[model samples]
Target: MLYFCPASVRVRAASGAALKPIQSINAHPSNCICIKFDPTGKYFATGSADALVSLWDVEELVCVRCFSRLDWPVRTLSFSHDGKMLASASEDHFIDIAEVETGEKLWEVQCDSPTFTVAWHPKRPLLAYACDDKEGKYDNNREAGTVKLFGLPNDS
Candidate 1:
């Protein structure tokens, strides 16, 4: 396979050879800001500065699909424990929960400011995310940043 960085990061094999990705992403110029690999390591997700989330196949090193509903540069990504879903966070004031296989947005969580980080419960469907107050833009009394959990089971 042709090995080149192409302005985007690449996956390097144990032998130090770069396995080329078959994606011609326009976001390469802007570059990816966050990335997450599924539990099985069969696939991975990349969140780009161009506001696109792309899923890549591990075997072929190809981009299988793209999710582009967010309007701002992506900041973070998380794969559900089971690898059935992905949470992509951005400064657009919302987080998108997408189905990994189809790239369909299953749900969204609105925010008061820029959300910079997100993660999933390793043993549950619970999702947690962190956001800033935009330097106390909405509430000067509030902290500079905060983290909240969503989808917590009542039993927990």
Candidate 2:
């Protein structure tokens, strides 16, 4: 069971047992924007308003890695189906993939529009990301969105 505390505080479980928290590490300057646990439940990643993404160990309860941003705040994060990669989306309108162990960015896709969400395929390596586009300068026309599929190359 993974949890996200906006202020980086460790939360107690519902069993009335207090879990020991490791030294607190601040991942983002602001509250966490989003968080997701890997399918295996071994680790979790956090997206933040400070434009950074952080990976934490579930068992150790300590942050293992942080990916800083240049200008955009990270809004969403997801792990690949196989848990080898991480995908992060931000207000910068781009989605980025990174190596889970090293926090090394592998690739990025620019949406050229505002993005709101990102998720991985349950059984495939494909990613589904959502973005919004305007039809006209004054058209405040916000329509239901779609998840644009982004493909990943074979790891081998």
lDDT of 1: 0.78
TM-score of each: 0.79, 0.79
Specify the poorest-scoring 10-residue window by lDDT in model 1: 11-20
Candidate 1 regions with alpha-carbon error over 4 angstroms = 1-27, 134-144, 153-156
Which lDDT tens digits does candidate 1 get at residues 6-90? Answer: 2554433333245444444333456677767899888877777789888888777787999999999889999999999999988
Residue 13 CA displacement from its true place in model 2, Å:
5.5
What is the Cα-based lDDT of residue 83 in candidate 2? 90
Model 2, CA-based lDDT: 0.73
Instruction: Rate residue 123 of model 1 by lDDT.
Output: 90
TM-score of predicted model 1?
0.79
